[model samples]
Target: MPCELCNAFENEKSRIIYSDAHVFVVPILHPIKDGHVMIIPIRHAENMKDLTAEEARAFMTAANLAMDAVKKEYGVTPMFLVNGWEYRSQPHLHAHVLPSKTNLRGLYAASEGVVGKIEASVEELTITADRIRVHFSYES
Candidate 1:
């Protein structure tokens, strides 16, 4: 099955926070808070469990770096998570990074008609990716 994330990843409008030969980080479309990021392998995998050891390491490293960048920008570490359903979502592997000081509830709420909420949709993701891109100016 085609994964929605794969389509999102290809969306140039999506916020691409960071990208290297092996991995890329983008903002979450439905962010829990202001600085929600997602990390994925440039070479898609079905799920985290299926990632090769090297791929796993690379993804984690990118996630950590993204987290640091979010902290630097937002003054909060934001919550982080990863989810995969073997039979659903194409089993693609991805990690979620959210920046918030209060409860994580802020991260999962719907974006409609909300104030001070950050949604990681294509447009918003692009803006956020640009913000994070500024911090990681030192490229590979």
Candidate 2:
């Protein structure tokens, strides 16, 4: 099976809120909080260290844009998270952008179905994506 990120890119799904040449931002399906998103490199790199300088720059730019969008839409400062290759479910390089004060423990439990996480429905995802997209200004 293709990587989920790759599939999202290929399908041009509603989950994608922003994209430039090097990176794209998508609302996380199982969000740690409302307005949680992810910045994913266009290329399939397993780790940040694997990214080229240009790719790194693009990722940072996109991440910043995502933070700004989340802040504007959700009225909260955003926190970014990265997992090393060993901890990643997908080998593709991506960084998470979440609202500050998000309960990380809740997010973990939600992922495992031990507790309910805010899983955006398709319509809700589309609205959230549009909310962020309108605030995203960095396009190259």
Candidate 3:
């Protein structure tokens, strides 16, 4: 079976906000905050080490663009995070960009001991995606 993120890249249900040839940005199905988004490469790669130079460049560009969109749409600078291999929920490489006023340590502590998924409804995802999309300068 394909990785879930790979499936999401192809699935309309993913609520994609922005996408280019190399990467795509989508609202997290289980967001830490209102504007949390994930920057994922089109090609499957376990981590940064696995990414080719082109892929790395694309990922960084996508991350920066997504962060800018989040900031413009939410009026808050997003926190960029990447879980280490041991903590990752999926094997695919993805960067989390979350709009939060809290510091990293506070965010990490709050996330700890949290059980069960806080899945977002399709409606909520759609609305959030639309909001971020409005601020995205790229055509997708």
Candidate 4:
């Protein structure tokens, strides 16, 4: 079975902040903090070690834009996180754009994913995504 994150990314019902042919950014189901977002490569590459140069670049672009958008839409600091679990199911490459003001230790303590006190609404997410696309994406 595919990882649930892949399925969640496909569902338009979820809050999507950014997307392109090579990548997409969606709200974290298990947010590590509020305004938390996930920037994912379209192709399933396990982890950083597995990502090709092109794929890494594309994902980085998405991550950079997602962080800017998140900060603009919600006043909070964004943290980029990647946990590689080769032994885990569906080890795809994904970047977590988590926004938080709390200290580092308190940040990782939330097992279920820290829910950022501020979350982007569906409309806000769309707008932020569009803005990012216009400013940074090739299609822009």
On TM-score, the leading prediction is 3
In candidate 4, stretches whose alpha carbon ends up further than 4 angstroms from where it belongs are 12-14, 84-90, 102-140
lDDT of each: 0.69, 0.79, 0.81, 0.62
**Candidate order (lDDT):** 3, 2, 1, 4
Worst 10 residues of 3 by lDDT: 102-111
Of the two candidates 2 and 3, the one with more favorable lDDT, higher being better, is 3
lDDT of 4: 0.62
Q: Write the per-residue lDDT of candidate 2 for residues 1-140, one digit (tens) a residue.
A: 77877666766465688887888999877665667788998888888999999999989998998999888887879888885345466778889888896555454554674544556678767787888888888656
Most accurate candidate by lDDT: 3
- Write model 1 residue lDDT over 31-75, tens digit each, in one string: 656676778877767667787788887888888888888888778
Residue 92's lDDT in candidate 3: 85
CA error at residue 115 for candidate 4, angstroms? 16
| Cα lDDT, model 1, residue 135 | 73
TM-score of every candidate: 0.72, 0.81, 0.84, 0.65
Once fitted onto the true fold, the runs of candidate 3 whose alpha carbons sit more than 4 angstroms away are 84-86, 102-114
lDDT of 2 at 98: 80
